[model samples]
Target: MKVLSGIHEPTKGTITINNINYNKLDHKLAAQLGIGIIYQELSVIDELTVLENLYIGRHLTKKICGVNIIDWREMRVRAAMMLLRVGLKVDLDEKVANLSISHKQMLEIAKTLMLDAKVIIMDEPTSSLTNKEVDYLLSSISDHESVA
Candidate 1:
């Protein structure tokens, strides 16, 4: 799985997605090929708002006079759409720390979905969830697959 995520390289092998050979897929190539991975450990930053977390790694920034400026309005619009797709309704500006564990998990899925990830690799998705949370996650995945 780490190999797929570009975190590790295979010693001797070939990875072909849809028959296209990615000799040694790095993070950029993996993302372009719509591959995303979600580990069991919660990765949402507690100090940031839901919106901030969504755009944390790859902010919608544009270069302007040698300065990188984040496009806040565009990000908020897209974040709202992603939340809707995930069946979540958290305030975009609300701190992640204030959300329940289930909600935080949902946020992570939303991020993956936003990447337009055709193939998602989840590691122990329900490791620390309540039975109820587990049910919610499973149901959400079912719905997503159906639509996909």
Candidate 2:
């Protein structure tokens, strides 16, 4: 999972996806190739709003006059839809720190779903969650599978 996600580059062997060879890769390429990982250790930033966190590292933008300007409206709409798909409703402007752990987890799932990844690896995602949270999380993942 790590190698496919491009967290590491194989030293002695090459990887092929769709007949493409890759000896060295990075996370950017992973996303480009429709691969992503959701670590057991969630990477939700506490200081950022739910909206901000959802778009972290994957901000949508347009270049105008050689300046990259973020497309806030489009991102907001997509973030809301992703959260809804996960059955997690959150105040888009709410800070992540103020949310419950479950909400944070849901937010993380929403973030990954928004990435349009073909495959996602979840690492012990239920360890810190409650039974109800786990149930919801699993159901959400199942729902994502149906959509995908």
Best by lDDT: 1
Q: lDDT for each of the candidates?
A: 0.82, 0.80
Clashes per candidate (backbone, < 3 Å): 0, 0
Q: What are the runs in model 1 whose C-alpha is more than 4 Å off?
A: 61-71, 143-148
TM-score of each: 0.77, 0.81
Model 2 bad stretches (over 4 Å): 61-69, 143-148
Reference-based lDDT, residue 145, model 1: 43
Give a tens-digit lDDT track for model 1, residues 3-28.
98888998887998988877688888
Evaluated at residue 24, the lDDT of candidate 2 is 72
What is candidate 1's TM-score against the reference? 0.77
